[model samples]
Target: MSPMETGLIGIGALFVLMVLRTPVAFAMLITGYFGMLVLEGSRAAGAVMLTESYSTVSNYNLIVVPMFILLGNIASAAGFSRGLYDAAFAWVGRFRGGLASSSVLGCAIFSAVSGSSVATAITIGKVALPEMKRLGYQDALSTGSIAAGGTLGFLIPPSTGFVLYAILTEQSIGRLFMAGILPGLLLMAAFIGTIALIATINPEAGPRGARVPLGQKFRVLVQSAPLIGIISISIGGIYAGVFTPVEASAIGAGLVLLLAFAMRQLSWNGFCRAILETVRTSAMLYMVVIGANVLNPFLAVTHIPETLGNAMVGLGLGPYGTLAIIILAYVVLGMFLDGLSMLVVTIPIIYPVILQMGFDPIWFGVVAVIVIEMGMITPPVGLNVFVVKGVAQDVPMTTVFKGVMPFLLAMIVSLLLIIIFPQIATLLPDLMFS
Candidate 1:
């Protein structure tokens, strides 16, 4: 068979492997290994394929990944979740839909440390759902907000997914990290606006609580000092060039560990749990990555990207039509695939085509992330939504989904706004990273 035909079949096999519940890394690795042998024969495939496993892992920029994940786990275990909720609540919890709004703020801040969406959603849900419920918020709005807000983890700086993207695309991780800042903030703003609109339309969905006392508000703000300090040190250090990405991550992880120990939150058992989970997650991610590295080359050998780029350029459809098709593709795949995997699987194919057609990769990354954000909230396999579902089981899945409807629409509009005004995504990274 032609290498292109074989490559296409390998793609089908990978998808089947995923659906059959094989580990994604294994699926990618096993498929990638044989596919290479099929295309390039035994000796050549063995030489290059063996090297990718460690070489890909050893890149200094990639070290930031585990540090970020460990930092997130430690922060969550160390009471960062409560601190974030308290700070957000002190200011926003008295307004109509206030508790729901607080969930959004909490997720955004939580995302700064915890770049994992499911982790972010589940952690914040445990802390915020009861608070919202006790404050007379409906389960639909409360859980839905937590689920929707969790999607911010990927859009924010320090996103593990974005890190993976930067590595995959060979872009400067710092620049992509900078690009995500404004888009993340914009997404949060859109969520808040949607909450206000919902509360206004149906006040019964969310009822207000009493205003926090001035002194109490200050106290809550004070409680967040550790989080603010850690976040500032880590992100600030990276931006200022005080440390490399890996160094910033390592420093953040160490600080979180010390903070957890000081706060009496880091027990022997919790510490053990954190390390094990980190290893497991890291292994899974690395496996898929190595697979993609091999698989990517295999695809490139087919000239698929070049061929597809030419085909798209040949199409009579204008720019908007191309954009629409890409967006539509994301929405469809999102129903089943998790966001990060979807991005990694699709972007390598789509990006070259995009750049060849004059779309900015940075702008495309933001635009791509926004579409994946929809996946995080969309049903069936929405990872964030499922995390919240695991938290608030009393609420039916449909209601949680229904409650997120307006936010989903708002998220789409946010994407449109970002696309229409490219500056929204580019401004921060351009100005700061400039």
Candidate 2:
């Protein structure tokens, strides 16, 4: 059989394994390994597997993954996430739909420290949901805000999604992190606007909470000092050129650890749990990276990217048209695939096409992340929606999904704005590196 045909069949097998509930990393690994054996003999396949496994794990740049994950896990264990929510609530809770807005802001801030969308959603949901509910916020708005807000974790600085994308595409991690900042803040603003619109239309869906006194607001801000300090040190230092991405992550993790201990917020057992969680999460990411690397070689042998890129160029749809198609595919696949899986599996084939089209890699990274954010709130496999549902037991899954619809629109709008103004994603990195 032709290499292209073999590649097609291998793709099918990968999907089949996924549909059978196999983990994404294993599916990619298995498909890539055997496909290579078919295309280049067993020796090449074995060598690729062994080389990717060792190379991926041993790459020093990858240390950022575990360090960032550890920072997040430590922040969660220390209850810093709650402090973030409280501080946001103190500032915005008195306005209409303030609680919901607070949830978005809180998630955005927490996302700076915690890299996982589900973790952001779960942590903020636990803090925001009860307050919104007690203040008579509608279930839809309450659940939807947290669900949508959680997705910010994928685009904000320290995002695991961006890390994986950088690894797959060989982009600069620090630049990707910087590119994410403006887009993240823009999307956060869009979510806040959506909440305002919702509250304006149906006041009962999100009632204003009692205003926080000036003194109390200051007190809440004080409580959030540790979170602010960590974000400033890690993300701030990266932009300031005071630290590399890996160094920033290490510093962030260490500072958070020290803060947690100082505040007595984390028990010794909690610290252990945090460390274990980081290891588990890091191992999973490593496996996926290794699998993607292995799969990339087989895809190269098949010339699938070249085949597809040529076909796309032949169609004369232009770069923008081609990009629109890719984004649409992401929206559709997101309904069934986890965001990370979608990112790793497709980037190897698609990224080359994008670069060939003359798009900025950093800008596209931001755009790709926003598309993944939509998937996190889209129906069927909206991971963040389900995470919020776990926190809001009485709220149906449909309600949470429905609530996120507006924010999803907001996200699309934010994406279009970024597309029109690439600087939104590039300005920070450009300025920083300059």
Candidate 3:
């Protein structure tokens, strides 16, 4: 049989494994290993598996993942996430749909540190959902906002999605992080506007929060300063060229640990738990990376990406037309796959086509991240929605999904703006690096 035919069968087996409830990382690994063994000899297949596994584990860039994850886990254990939510609520809660807006803001802030959508959603939803409920906010709006807002974890700086994308596409992590900034803020603003519109249309859906005195607002902001300061120093250092992303992550984690100890907020038990959680999460991410690395060799041997790129060029649909088609395919995949799985699985195939179409890789990273973010709130496999549902146990899954619709539309609008004017994603990186 031809190599291309073997590759096609391997792809089918990968999907079948996923449908059978096998873990995504294991499924990819299994499919790639067996496909390679069949195409070559057992020696070549074993060498590929061992070499890729070692290289992936030893990769310096990957160190950033564990550090930032530890920073977030430590921050959450120390109650710094709660401080951020309080500060956002104090400042914005008085306006119409203010509580929900504050939730989005809080998610955005926490996302800067967490870099995981599930972590961001659970952290903020725990704080914001109860308050919105107590204040008589509709379940749809309150839960929806948290689910959609958690998606910022994938788009904002220090994003795991961008980290993996950069590693896969051989792009700069700093440039990708910088590219995400404006687009992230644009999406955040769009989410806020969606909340305001919902409240405007149905006053009862989101009532105005009680106004805080100016002094109190300042006090709450002060209380939230430690986490904010760490985020600024770490993420800011990257943009300022003061440090590499790995160094920034180390500094951030160290600072958060110091703050937690100084405040007496993190006990010995809490510290141990944070370490354990970080190891578990980081290990899972590492496995996914290893699987992708192994699978990539198999795909190359089959000439699949090359063949797909050639087919796309033959279509003669201009750049934008081809882009629209790629985005549509991503949305369909997002409905079934989690963000990281989707990234590791598809980028190798789609990336070449993107570059062939003359689109900037950095800009496309931002666009791709946003599309993945949309998937987090999309139905069926909406991971963030499930996270929010876990926090707000009484709220039904359907209500959370309904609440995310407007924000989903907002995402589409923000995506269109970025596509029409690519500079929104590229400007900061261009200015900073140039």
Q: Against the true structure, whose lDDT is highest?
A: 3
Instruction: Tell me the tens digit of each residue's lDDT in model 1 across 147-181.
Output: 88998998887888778888788887777777888
lDDT of 2 by residue, 1-97 (tens): 9999999999999999999999999999999999999999999999999999999999988999999999999999888888899999899989999
lDDT of 1 at 323: 76
> Higher-TM-score candidate among 1 and 2?
2
* Model 2, residue pairs in steric clash: none
Models ranked on lDDT:
3, 2, 1
Error of 3 at 48 (Å): 0.7
Which ranges of candidate 2 are over 4 A from the true structure?
Answer: none
Q: What are the Cα lDDT values of the candidates?
A: 0.83, 0.93, 0.94
lDDT for model 2 comes to 0.93
TM-score of candidate 2 relative to the true fold? 0.99
**Residue pairs with clashing backbones, model 1:** none
- In angstroms, the error of model 2 at 369 is 0.8
Per-residue lDDT, model 2, residue 119, is 88
The runs of at least 3 residues in candidate 3 whose Cα sits more than 4 Å from the true structure, single-residue gaps closed, are none
Tens digits of per-residue lDDT, candidate 3, 1-434, equal 99999999999999999889888889989988999999987998999999999999999999999999999999999999999999999999999999999999999999999998889999999999999999999999999999999999999988999999998998999999899889989999999999999999999999999989999999999999988999999989999999999999999999999999999999999999999999999999999999999899999999999999889889998889899999999999999999998999999889999998899999999999999999999989999998999999999999999999999999999999999999999999999899
lDDT score of model 3? 0.94
